[model samples]
Target: MTRCRLCGSTALESVVDLGATPPCESFLAAERLDAPEPTYPLHLRVCTDCWLAQIPPLITPEETFSEYAYFSSYSSSWVEHARVFVEDAAARLGLGEDSFVVEVASNDGYLLRHVVDRGVRCLGVEPSVNVGAAAREAGVPTLTAFLSPETGAAVRAEHGPADLVVANNVYAHIPDVIGFTKGLRALVADDGWVSVEVQHLLTLIEENQYDTIYHEHFQYYTVASAIRALASGGLTLVDVELLPTHGGSLRLWARPEEAAGEPGRRVADVLAREKAAGLQELSGYTEFSARVAKVRRDLLRFLVDAAEEGRTVVGYGAPGKGNTLLNHCGIRPDLLPYTVDRNPYKHGRYTPGTRIPVLPPERIAADRPDYVLVLPWNLRAELVEQLAYVHEWGGRLVFPIPELSIVEVER
Candidate 1:
């Protein structure tokens, strides 16, 4: 992009160019295998002026989320995480049966179900028609719409202002950052809290989690840039917490400027950590491209060697991040014959660009593949436990991001 999406400055520098890849979630059907798939530039750049890392908004959210493929309830660990967050939020905010909560991008009612059980009234604003239907089936009062300024205002007017607004793992999906933030302000009460959970740019660089970069994720944030983004919408950062989900993420607490007092010491401490990691300057990003290249090389070498040795290697999950890694490394079915996922929607589909077949999780046990490459490595602990049966067949698990490592499972 010519100018920074957040600051509107022309001082953007390259962090990494992952070449071109299709929209990661665009799985292919057998009937459409012969049709040409479209791709877009997967380049990430950091703005020297605002320190916000972003990609060109080549794809729109409507194209990706209208009939979303990802169903959040598939991951048991994530659902439990949401449950804990709801319990803690209710206690922290003194929420009761009379309190109201709103969650943006609430996928499949995975989180709001916990809110519903607490006897507190809640609503979910989601764009995808299918997932919204699923949420309604689960008894979550959901409005099928994207969160813009108008939608937020309408929800507030009808339901009254929310006592707490929770937006988890969706801050990076929207191209219009300022407008989305304004919508957040309009939904929340003047004194109510707004909690946003997003992947931290600091952990992304330090851990070499380049696979998470994709077209749907238009921007990345550090606490410093997040403060600026929140300010643009009349919201102020009040407290910060480090979370281990999605490799590493930030849970930022914000409020309207009128009620947002001085930011807590945790916010300043995290800012100091970011500055120490060189995220506020150019030096932090200079070596990321090289590290990303090393990850690509190591993964390809292992897959090729496995194929040459007549040892089968299949993928564990067909997540969006896995598509980026597979497409970037130029892996086809020859290296990874097929992958399996718990989501039934992807059971008979093929991964975008790579065209590798996706099967059910039972296939791993049925086929007894020599190695199962774990794509959604962020859920390592949960998958390791679930796939422990692989040890029965002397199968091992492989993780690609943060470094390439193969682990032996104990039955």
Candidate 2:
């Protein structure tokens, strides 16, 4: 980029190439029956100063989320994750009915419901109309617009500055990284801090999570890089926490410049770790593309080999992450005949780039394919339990990421 999205630093290094892939959420609709599928270069970069992992801009927030498709409630594990976060945050923030809370990119009110249940005043800033409506139905005060400096001012004038701001996994979703952080500064109270959770860039490299590189996840954040980004908006890093969830993420707390309280030791420790890991230098990113390519070769080899033998393989979960995986690996109906999902919105629709038919998950038992691929491997436990019936027919579940494995069920 011209300057680092996180720090405005001009020094950046090109890292892994996810190759060209379609936008993860561009699921084929009836209107696209005869239309051509579009794919853009899916690549990631690392900041020499901030160590933030990021992708070159191919789309905008308005274009990416105007008709959003992902819904949080569809993932049982994520819902439980949200519940736990709600409980812990309530205790930590000591929030009560009068304290206002806001969550940007509040998909379907999965997290805000707990705040509402606690009788706390809360609002959800969601750009997608469909998801915004879902939050409204769930009793959250929903602001159906993209959060910007102007929008944040309007929201503050009406709803007042938030006592707490929670942005889960959405910190990387904004194209205007600087603008969004500035808006965050405007929306939060003078002393109130904003906690943002983003997938750790180091983990993405170590675990070979190239599939996370989709159109929406515009700017990835590392603590070193995030500090610079936050500072651009008159905010300072207050504390940082390492979260095991989402394959290792960082929960960073930040407040305006004049806010009191020293930066936590975690911030310094993580920064040191990144430096030791060479995140402050450009060479750290150069080797990632080879690792990603290896993953692609291995996964494609396994799937295509199974297909050639006439051993049918079906997939589970229509997550955006899965879409990126499918597209980057060039997986289509040949290697994987079809996939299934729990979300009614995605059911009966095809996965965006792969064109893999998305049926109701119940179809798995109906067809009893030789191998059931778990697309969203994060929910392996629930998926295996729900599909335990496969054991009766000598069927097995296959998970290809982090490492390829077969979940064999006893007869």
Candidate 3:
């Protein structure tokens, strides 16, 4: 934390300190609820030299991803998103039966299944034993191991060089940014491509998406910083695409330095936008802490008002970001009572720090709560359609991020 993870500099400045909280994915079993739960300081800092926003590496990936709770196939929209990405990537890259595709941190084979359907040889490198088993059961070849330079080279040696390496939503998960990037470089063919999708720091600050910050997410990236990080691993950013997923994200297309030519105009355009937003300097981050504080205050006020007025408020989706929001706002079961998710892995378990009960999706309809707080706001469109049935019982949906707003769903 004292030195930049990407750049070896000691000019890191405070971004926001979210206080102490347990690992966001550490759901408590009924029996383990009595045991002591550990928490770590959730502070974010940006290196002035490289502008890479990061948190301390307090916890290891082995502790969290060894047996992950999240299953990407649980959400129909995310599955469809993966399917579309696979189809487009195959067409764009002219991938065929001869092309070999590999996805790092591939959870439950959600994306690789599409690659398999296309008759393309593919493999999933996942760290989680349980979810990796699920992927293998679904007919996707998966290797249960973490992604390191050694792991990457081993995969290439055994399976041969991959034509396309897809790493979605995992660029920020590792603490060793340079090492992870080098692993990515080693996985793909010398002339092949690597596509990485990560949440953009631009939207995280502008949209008040502070809940995405957690112990597992070691660093956040802007296109400017991302360019530097990619080069550290001997990969060059050739193209960039702005995506709507995860509130906002960047899909960076890269390749081995020798094969990478001039970066596309989109890369320059996005970097221009980041600069215009003042992310490269101190001006962009100066107001983020204050904005985050206001969000916490506003959400707490609404929850308190609802309780006093005798309105029943429950939560939807037991996502990791929800844990950050709950713990940061100091919300307890009394305020939230219970939350529901489609992922049965979390049912009957309690949120790590808030200790809110996670139930099945049917519980919301059966209980008929007056309001359902939507936790995974990034999936707003998908959840809105799924929860439209709440209108049958006069239940409205609540979103707490990007400012608190209540929406009435139509049947």
Worst 10 residues of 1 by lDDT: 1-10
255 in model 2: Cα distance from truth in Å? Answer: 1.9
Off by over 4 Å in 1: none
For TM-score, candidate 2 versus 3, the one ahead is 3
Each prediction's RMSD over C-alphas, in Å, is 0.6, 1.8, 0.6
Candidate 1 has a TM-score of 0.99
- Flag regions of model 3 displaced more than 4 Å: none
Q: Per-residue lDDT for 1-411 in model 1, tens only? A: 899877899999999999999999999999999999999999999999999999999999999999989999999999999999999999999999999999999999999999999999999999999999999999999999999999999999999999999999899999999999999999999999999999999999999999999998999999999999999899999999999999999999999999999999999999999999999999999999999999999999999899889999999999999999999999999999999999999999999999999999999989999999999999999999999999998999999989999999987
**Which regions of candidate 2 fall more than 4 Å away from where they truly are?**
7-10
Candidates 1 and 2, the one with greater lDDT: 1
Model 1: pairs clashing at backbone N, Cα or C within 3 Å = none
Model 2, C-alpha of 334: deviation from truth (Å): 1.1
lDDT of 3 by residue, 257-308 (tens): 9999999999989999999999999988999999999999999999999999
State TM-scores per candidate: 0.99, 0.95, 0.99
